[model samples]
Target: MDLELKGKVAIVTGASQGIGKAAALRLAAEGARVVIAARGRELLDRVAQEIRAAGGSVAAVPADVSRAEDCARLVAEAVKAFGRLDILVNNAGTSATGAFESVTDELWQADFELKLFAAIRLARLALPHMNRQGGGRIVNITNIGAKQPRAKSMPTTVTRAAGLAFTKALSKEFAPQQILVNSICIGSVRAGQHEAKAAKAGVALEQYYANLAKDIPLGRVGRAEEVANAIAFLASGAASFITGSSINLDGGASAVL
Candidate 1:
């Protein structure tokens, strides 16, 4: 499983921690030069240094994805550093859980700005560069809530649903140019914010994760690396024929297709 990714370049957003960090390390492990982006400069730089310490090629670019300028700068910096971009993983996002009536217009708009608009802007910027190169890959990290639609998850569910639609639409648009676009819907994963939440709950970390994992048929939440593995496949030549598809990596938490 060479992944045939040697020398290929990838841009991973939200790469400071959580699944984004996992994806960045995995891509670098597979021999792809990686550009890690996030708003936290120190955290992003630390992750980049970890990759380099493992003998992987990586550069850190601190930028907020919600801004159009940052999105363009991210891609531009990747190209400038690596010469070409082969993959884009839109993983930066924010979560808001509230009833439909409780969620304000500002809340919805802010969530969209972080999750949906960022992906849209990055895809738009990457399209011409990918088209010029003849082909590329884009993997959007959405959520299972997009398909399931929980009542308390009004904002996240609505925005993630739109993100799925965006992935599908981009897939069709990029197909002719050989740029494959796909998405991965995440389930519960023990990382970053989740760990912080667990700590705040005053619960034993292992027990908290175990309790959370009990809901899935697989009897556990997914690992960040597991989701990253799927992203790697979608980004690789092995998935050349795959586009406009949504894959779930939720340890059987998502019952829907």
Candidate 2:
């Protein structure tokens, strides 16, 4: 059960809440020094403080991943705090729901910049550091919509597809250097967004979740921690040979390859 991650350093984006927060905590639990980056300074600081209270080494760096300078800053800040970077989790993206005709140019640009371009900038910045360390791991938190596109998701579908492509191509490029790059395509998970939507609908949380679960084959949406576990495994030495692959973490919601 030893992830062999002690003394390792990791950078997790969108780490203020949900999956990113869960991943950050999980990595720290496994004995890795963690740097949590996100747009919300307060939330990021809270997560860092919580981890520290749990006897984990952590630092909070608030940065909007959409900006290239911010992405570079995120990497720089993590390295400054941890001395080295061993893992990069690109998890700072939002789900966009809109039809092709309804999607605005601004929305498309925003999605691409936030999800695809952000990953590109961070990965580019982290490459040299990982190469210097002789090896590292990169995990991109894409969505199942990337593979199972729907009419309602225009920009998210397209941009996540690009992220998947980035994951695969970069994985191949970094494998020779012993760095493993992979993507995790998440499906419906119990997140703050869902909770907010449920509250707005004036429905009991359990009823709301049950209604949402009707569409999933597992009869329920996944927990953020569930996805974090998979990410931890992939980032750890346990998945040393895994790269250039997209692992779907949907509860049979996505039937595509």
Q: What C-alpha lDDT do the candidate models reach, one value each?
A: 0.91, 0.92
After the best TM-score superposition of candidate 1, give how far the Cα of residue 15 lies from its true spot, in angstroms: 0.6
Clashing pairs in 2: none
lDDT of 1 by residue, 56-144 (tens): 99989999999999999999999999889889999997567887889899998889999999999999888888888999999999999
Best by lDDT: 2
Tens-digit lDDT track of model 2 for 16-102: 999999999999999999999999899899999999999999989989999998988889989998899999999998768786889
How close is every model to the real structure, measured as TM-score? 0.97, 0.97
State in Å the error of residue 152, model 2.
1.3
Instruction: Give the poorly placed runs of model 2, Cα more than 4 Å off.
Output: 200-203
How far residue 116's Cα lies from its native spot in candidate 2, in Å, is: 0.6
Worst 10 residues of 1 by lDDT: 190-199
